[model samples]
Target: MKHRFFPAVAALLAFGAAHAAPCPRDAPLPSGFERWAHPGLGVAAWQESGTYQATLPLGRAVTLHLPDIGTVHFIVPPGGKGSHGPYGGMIGIDVPSGATYRVMLSGRAWIDMVQDRADLPSSAHQHGPDCTGIAKIVSFPLHAGWHVLQISGAPDPTITVMMSSTP
Candidate 1:
């Protein structure tokens, strides 16, 4: 089991690197958030530190740089389902529409993306050789509209979630 661990980690690292951009180290505030919060850009990157909700435009790719430690939960409303995942790496988001929104999550986590409140995610990526440090990229099809993105379950007192445009 241990022998294969090294190779597995290597593969995960490579996979993460390939999809590194589009998800930078800073999570952008909802367009004009400064008018109210006045926190400034990069100030509210972590999930626990500041503003956790942001509105993503249609067909924009963004990256949320997760903390180096702890578990994280990303919940999208309508279904109000939250995906519990591991710490570190980046989460890529490309929103063409809710039905075509793409979410790429790395590290240890459980993804339960459900379009309907009753139906569960068709698949899940668990922690292991292929999913170590980060899991596979999962896409969820939801309704077209502004969906509230929520984050939680960070072991650390504070953690940053970065968002950037994807190329």
Candidate 2:
């Protein structure tokens, strides 16, 4: 087969580069995170070297960032209903209203994402992924803040959080 003259252009098309962004389908946290945690319903988290906690009220989404290693986690509450999910124990996060948040990271590994809808409730367990090379990202909507957004898992991975348009 013939190759394209532009190497960058060739790679982008070959790997669906245009679609690459902090998306739920794309796990932002590094792959080694699998060794730390996998994505799922209930309280999915990672324990590095710190602690965190928060409780979302309702119809809100919270975004947490671990820029130290390039990883972002969000806890969103699906409005109303049973909030069904594959698992449980995942912390309830409080999200800011009308806000767009995103996390960015790059590496190679696997991040399993699971969420609970208002119609279905998750099991209340921990889920995660095995990240590698510092690659991961997560994006979602927010309208409030939960007592959540805690550093529950990674007791100390040397993480940090950055808010969008902070006053």
Candidate 3:
């Protein structure tokens, strides 16, 4: 009987690969997290839900500092290596509390000389039109603890900062 219909089509493909539905678990990575390269006091933390991975050293130009807050920023451009920076860089943050944010980048962004550059303290700027600091396209808004993500240009890009969970 065709091997009993291949075991019922392999048990319906293992029940559709275990329901095949996730991503609601929320991302959260920040606890003894360590991935040193130039830890000259480098910061790459996440909470509310988490995921973190920062590895730099291909050309040399890395920066990630966000001690606490809602937090936001993500850039992963190494797919086929198109010379590197075609566009991807700019961030000025600071959010002590009341969290909420998201951002991911690869190409397309705006900012002059990287204003704020991760000093974010003037009451944690977040005042209109999505904070209005010039964040091309990615995802952003984070406050509560620290949020100082300042990624620039492209040299050793290994950006992957995912976070979701603020309830």
Q: In model 1, which regions exceed 4 Å deviation?
A: 1-53, 57-61, 65-98, 111-134, 150-167
Ordered list by TM-score, greatest first: 1, 2, 3
| Residue range 105-162, candidate 2, lDDT tens digits | 2222122222232222222222223322223344444444432332222323333222
Q: Of models 1 and 3, which has the larger TM-score?
A: 1
Best by TM-score: 1
Per-model CA lDDT versus the true structure: 0.35, 0.32, 0.33
Query: What's the best-to-worst order under lDDT?
Result: 1, 3, 2
lDDT of 2 at 106: 29
Per-residue CA lDDT of model 3 for 1-167, tens digit only, reads: 99999999999999999888653443332231222122232344332112223322211223444332223343322122333343233232334455444332222322111112233222122211222222232333444543334444333333333222222
| Stretch of 10 with least lDDT, candidate 3 | 106-115
Write down the lDDT that model 1 would get. Answer: 0.35
Is candidate 2 or 3 superior in lDDT? Answer: 3
TM-score of each: 0.32, 0.24, 0.22
